[model samples]
Target: MSATSVSSDRVDHLWKGVRAGVPIFVASAPFAVLFGAMAVENGLTVAQAVLMSAAVYGGASQMVGIELFGQHVAPWLIVFSIFAVNFRHVLYSAAIGQHVPHWSPLRKAVAFFFLVDPVFAESERRVENGKRITIIWYAGMALPMYCSWILMTWIGAEFGSQVMPDAHAIGLDFLLSIYFLGLVMGFRKRPRWLPVVLVSAVVSVIAYRTIGSPWHVSIGALAGILLAAALPPRAALPLEAAAVEEATS
Candidate 1:
């Protein structure tokens, strides 16, 4: 294809990725609204709310940050905690490193800012055909998600708590467990993650109840990493093969 035709085709392919992201946006919207409301109620300013959405762009990590913020944790510690919670992004960078080899330094930096767990999960799950993925597709996904986050945060900062009465009694806490369980189940079709789930959950609950810190998430993630790393390569290879098959097929 001519260069112009190739560029156009790439744009079209990216639009498809954005369209595929719609369902995820639907899943994320309510949670973003909830986080916005909670952040504001916990005393974050509208600017802070929107900034975290724009800067952090991490739903779970933002929630954890706000929880720590509310607990009167030092700002530096809060920053460190957020970093620890999101450290897994480094692994994601390594995984996709070869795919986007020609990306400029500035482009790489911009892409990292918008990276979040769901974006990582979905993109990794559905990489396209022989055509190398372009930066435009990643940006397309970030654009809407970023807008929704800040818009929802602004709305909630201004009005969410007033409207969302007795939300605590409704037990949305269960949703966190449910959501994590769903993710685990999604990965559990393979055997390796079955142990990862069991060990991670057990480690998480113990850490949460004992060495309580907003940073407990880092501990749990480390537990999974350590356990997964320690698994016999022979035993883990089958699960890895299944995951690859699922991703490719």
Candidate 2:
């Protein structure tokens, strides 16, 4: 596509992505409620829980933050651990950077603040050519999700203890797994990408044993990148075609 065509398509795609992603944000409600319940279980005050949702705005990081805080890990370690867990966002930023390259540093930083795993995965899939997807689409996904998270967190912190006799047993934590699976099943249509997922899991296990908590995510990211580099597919479409062929054959 011509540069102009690509830019225009990107904007169009961004608009569509925003519209499509709005439902995902709405679908995130139950999970946000679960996060709030988890926050309360972790002994966060309602204010702290809500603020963490607003400030961190990253589900996995907030979960990890609560876990670290509950363990009484040093505050500096908690900060570094959450940062390490979230560092993969740097890669996400790089992927979508072209779409918004001309945006100022302040604007970029603001966009980065709302960057989370789901929005990153969704936006990356929708981007084309070298054009950057507009940050507004990301905001469209993040802002409402953010509000839902904070409000639900406040409610959970206030009332969850009174209601759920065993919140963990109720399986609220599974929402995290389900959310991840949704992202993976969406983008990982290629057989080659399957190996990256496996390698990432293996690396995470190894890192969990050797490096422990926060550093494991860093190792997993490195392993994932290496795996992707090693097993580059011909194209995403070819992978889909291969799957169809296999199923028919």
Candidate 3:
């Protein structure tokens, strides 16, 4: 392709990515604002609240950190808690890493930096549709959400000083749980899903009763992950069998 056409294609790809990412960013905006409000409510300055949104980026980790900070917990413990909450990103990267083998080390690093939950979902959706994840496109999608998150954080910090009273109390913090549950349900048709979900839920309940709050969360997720990994994938049958299955369906 000519130089002009290449540049045009890059711009086209970027704009397409931005368009695709709009709904995700819009959906996540409330959580971004809430995080900012909580950060300031927990004694962080407005600048600090915005900075945390820009730097940390993980909603769960940021909330856990701010909550721990408010409780006067030790700094190391706070760091550990945040790490525990974000540990799943390691799995996310592992699962998707092979799709971008051609991405350079620096490109991979930059891409991973923007790999939040919604971003991961969109990327995986593209892969399922057999689309390639170009660098410019990834930037276009990620930047809008990333920038809006910081902006919303500032808005929350500036306005939440008085109104931050019952936001958390009214159960806004549970929004993430509902959002994630919906995502998990989206995969209910996948193979062996029932076993994995049942095992995970049972383990999580047991852990919640025994190990307690935060730890139970991770433990239950881990149990499901382990069960999924251990379960053998369904094998493809022969042509005759496949034909019969398709006929029945």
Tell me model 3's lDDT, rounded to 2 decimals: 0.77
Per-residue lDDT tens digits of candidate 1, residues 1-249?
Answer: 799999898789689778856766777787777778878877898788878887887776787788788889779888877787566566555555556788898998778676565666556665545555578777777668778877887777677778877766865445555654554565555546778877877887889899886545668878987988888765444432453433333
Model 1 regions more than 4 Å off: 1-14, 121-126, 172-174, 180-225, 235-249
The alpha-carbon lDDT assigned to residue 162 of candidate 2 equals: 77
lDDT of 3 at 70: 85
State the lDDT of candidate 2 residue by residue for 1-249, as single tens digits. 799998886687556656757765776666666677778787788788888888887776787788777778679978977786676566666655655777789988887776665666555555533434666556665666667767877877777777777656876656567755665565465456678888888999999999887567668867987777777456545432333322222
Ranking by TM-score: 1, 3, 2
Collision pairs in model 1: none
TM-scores of all predicted structures: 0.75, 0.63, 0.73
For each candidate in the order shown, give its overall lDDT on alpha carbons.
0.70, 0.68, 0.77
Q: Model 2 residue 77 lDDT?
A: 78
After TM-score superposition, what is the CA distance of residue 1 in candidate 1 from its true location, in Å? 7.8
Q: Candidate 2, which ten residues in sequence have the lowest lDDT sum? A: 240-249
